[model samples]
Target: MSSAFLPGFFLGFSLILAIGAQNAFVLRQGLRRQHVFWTCLTCALSDAVLIAVGVAGFGHLAMLAPWLDLAMRLGGAAFLICYGGLALRNAWRGGAALHAGGGDGSTLLATLLSVLTFTWLNPHVYLDTVVLIGSISAQYSDRLAFGLGAVCASFTFFFGLGYGARLLAPFFGRPRAWQVLDGLIGLTMWAIAAKLLVM
Candidate 1:
């Protein structure tokens, strides 16, 4: 990629690097050893879609529709709150993977739900990774360069997220670690929701 595109690539990287609902979910699934490969694939693929949409200049569709923005923000906030609440509940209960016994069937379906949880349900994912990144890329007007940067950024994020979480799994084996994770996730989600309400 050209040097001019580096800034946008980093822009995408910085926006996604922060701990958020999607990251948390990714971490949890990684810990559970549940649909690990496909989970990463879906995350990257979803990012690819969003990045393509932005670099292609179709993100204007999102900006033009007030209802779209509101619906996404509202839905995102609600999903965060509910998921966070679940995390908090799990935290209180303590210990490794919840409902492990139920992990018997349909790994593909479970993975798909996890993908949706990270992609569609998380409001911050769209605003930061999709809208913000797209808008920034649009400023350059060199669609080719902007797109290259966006795709690079997406690959970096999903790779780090999907595999990076695995790095943390060894640590989660200790007692109460899962609880701490859940508590942190709950807080992260609620904080994101609060930020959304103001926007």
Candidate 2:
């Protein structure tokens, strides 16, 4: 069980550490101190649910439907490209700032919706959390332990990212920092979109 748990933990952490739209959104919300807890909880819980589904053999079901995968890929690419464009525009206008105010004018409901959309709508999430992790878990005799380990990884990462963002608050205090961050985010979004389309 320990062996399975360790491998699962590392696999999960490595995948989640990759910079992507989901991480970008979480970081931004964390920096803004707006709904950070809810955002993190949503992300972690969502990952856990997906991982469980995957481990339960949903990956096989997904493989049985090529059309569904294609549709998800196309939709995900479109969303990413649009989001990237918005981020680029924000960077250009110098409007991407970490406001010290209570909220960024985004209501709690809106924030949660955005967070959920970012999580569920991305095809990469399915590929990573469902297909990849699920396939990998089959190698371990104690698959349940492995799945639990992966779930723990999600909880650890999201909460850490959400709460730990404050440590960088001073650096992000500068307007230029926001500009650079948004610029990178825009590029990341575009890159991932291109990957999805090409793949």
Candidate 3:
């Protein structure tokens, strides 16, 4: 189990380093400096829960209920499409210039709900954190250590990303920068949704 720790940490980084919908949302929230701590914590904890489930050998649940994949795919695609459209609209409007100590005026509940939706509703998250991680952990004698390492990686990455975004505060002061960011995020979301549909 101890030997698997490093492998798990690196694997976790490899899997989550991609700029997916969830990551995009986190980046956006981080850049906005809105609910950074809670956002990062929620993402980390969500990954931890899924990792634990995977390490516990619950990956077979997907096999036991194949329909679950299709259901999640459809639901996820729908939500992504809607969210992507909203983002694109925001981009087109060209507002949302960043101000010091100011936020987008969203409530904490709304922010959490958005992050949770981005994390839990996305089928790819389950694929990466549960199925893939679970299957890989099975190869090791110390699955618990491997899972813990992956969990730690998750916590580290989320907090680092959420806080590290502040470094770009100077750049985001321009409204055009926010527009470009929103445009990219919208396109990314739509692309993921399209992939989900095709899958």
Candidate 4:
């Protein structure tokens, strides 16, 4: 059980650590200090549910739905491209900064909705949390332990990122820092979108 848990933990962490739309949004909201706790909680809980479903063998159901893949890929690509464009526009505007006060602040409901979209609309999340992780868990006799480990990884990561972003507030105080961050985020979105299109 311990052995299964460790591998699941590391694998889950490695997968989530990669820079993507979900992580980018979480980090941005975290830095802004807007509903960080709820945002992180939603993300972590969503992952927990998906991970549980995967372990319960719903991954095979996902595999059977070839059309779902096409729909998700198209939707995800469009969403990423649109988001990337917005980020680039924000960068070009050159006045954005991470501050407690407003400069495009959103309500909690809106923020959570966006977070949900970023998490669920992105096909990669399904691929990673469901198909890949689920398929791998079959190899272990202690699949429940492995799934729990993955859930732990999700909680650790989302909470850490959401809360930890505050530490970078000082650096993000400058407009230039925001520009750089937004630019990088834009590039990441486009890159991922390209990958999705190609795949």
Please give, for residues 1-199, the per-residue lDDT of candidate 4 as tens digits. Answer: 5789988898899999988999998898887788889999999998988888888888989767789998988898998999999999888887734443243668899989988988998888988898888989999999999999999999999999989988888888888888888899999999999999999
lDDT of 3: 0.89
1-199 per-residue lDDT for model 1 (tens digits): 5664787778777877778777777666766667766776777778778777776767667657778777877878887788789879878987544432223244688667857776876666676656777778767857667667766786777666766666776677664777787799999989988887789
Query: Per-candidate TM vs. native?
Result: 0.84, 0.93, 0.96, 0.94
User: Which has the greatest TM-score?
Assistant: 3
Candidate 1 weakest lDDT stretch, 10 residues:
96-105
Candidate closer to the true structure by lDDT (higher is better), 3 or 4: 3
Give the higher-lDDT candidate: 1 or 2.
2
Ranking by lDDT: 3, 4, 2, 1
Q: What does candidate 3 score on TM?
A: 0.96
> Local distance difference test, per candidate?
0.72, 0.86, 0.89, 0.87
Ranking by TM-score: 3, 4, 2, 1
Q: How much is 9 displaced in model 3, in angstroms?
A: 0.6
Query: In model 4, which regions exceed 4 Å deviation?
Result: 96-103
TM-score of 1: 0.84
What's the distance in Å from true for residue 77, model 3?
0.5
